[model samples]
Target: MFSADALIQTSGNIVGGTAGAFLGGYFAIKVMRTQIEFQRKQNQQEKEEQYEKTYWLMKLVFEGLGSSIDDFQKTMNKPDIDDKKDYPYLIGLLKGTLSVSKEKKELINDNYIPKDIYREYLAGITLFNSCEFIIERWYQTLHLDNFKISTDNYQFKDLIVYGNGMRHIFNEIESIKPIKKKVTTTGGGAK
Candidate 1:
């Protein structure tokens, strides 16, 4: 049998314990939610940063390669140009500019890229690679003693045709706001 005073004291303790447990659980959940939200924001920030880095890299590559292509065409047309000197210089410039794109290519598949412009971005990359491929073939002939200026201007012609599209895509990408990708969905469902 319990004394009346003891019963009241036990009741009070049980109530206190229940309230303490509830409060502790509630605060614990609040802290967890806060941490999760913070993590999400941090992830978003990282994605935006990656997007910016990729954008700048692409910009430099497009401009650099485009300029090199133009110079190659002009140099090729020069009647008095030295094949050994000018051709190698233009090839070196193109390859050097392309190395930047090659090194950071992993960023192309990142989630930060804008969905609408992804195809164009890929097209630009393809054009770049095509140009590099042609240049590599030409570079292979450089060591030959019989090296002569070949009149196969078709590849450079194709590059000229695509250069306009690349410039347009660059402008469109530049106009995009940072982290605009978050508002869009990566999966297929509804708009």
Candidate 2:
């Protein structure tokens, strides 16, 4: 039979080892959760910034286009060009600035620009460097050729007024980003 003193010591050691393991496991989980939370917050912030940047740039482009379209409509309605008439300033502005605002230009230029035209496509390239701002040439049948023409004024106006639904979409996106992220992260929700 085992001695009573030996049994007491063994029971004490078992309890101590279990308590140590439990504390270690709890601390490790706490540290892991803290790191995960930090990562989640950082990612959420980046997503918000990206959404805002895209929203603002698109809004500016739409505004510029809408302004130009308005001027075009007014000019087209006029019977003849008057020597005294001061041309719409935006006509030159779009031509000069590619319809991009100063802030948008700074954002676009932050990405590295490569001189070589023929370079392999790389993932994670900024939207500015990757996307092309192109206006397909639309020939105005009667007198104008090689000019970009927008057919609908109302749609263009809407685009300027509302950056093509980005505002609403981003609002919903932001709501999801901030609230109940843990539930969403758990992968239980339907897409």
* lDDT values for all models: 0.70, 0.43
Candidate 2 residue-wise lDDT at 38? 100
| Candidate 1 deviant stretches above 4 angstroms | 73-92, 99-117, 141-152, 177-191
Which is the leading candidate under lDDT? 1
Cα TM-score per model: 0.68, 0.48
Summarize candidate 2's per-residue lDDT along 1-191 as a digit string, tens digits.
Answer: 99999999999899999999999999999999999999999987775565455545544543444454445456644666442332323234334444254345446332332222112112112222212132111111213333323435443344333322333333443343332232334547667
For all predictions, the C-alpha RMSD in Å is 9.3, 11.9
Model 2, position 169: C-alpha lDDT score? 34
Clashes of 1: 0
**Relative to the unseen true structure, what is the C-alpha lDDT of residue 190 in candidate 2, on a scale of 0 to 100?**
67
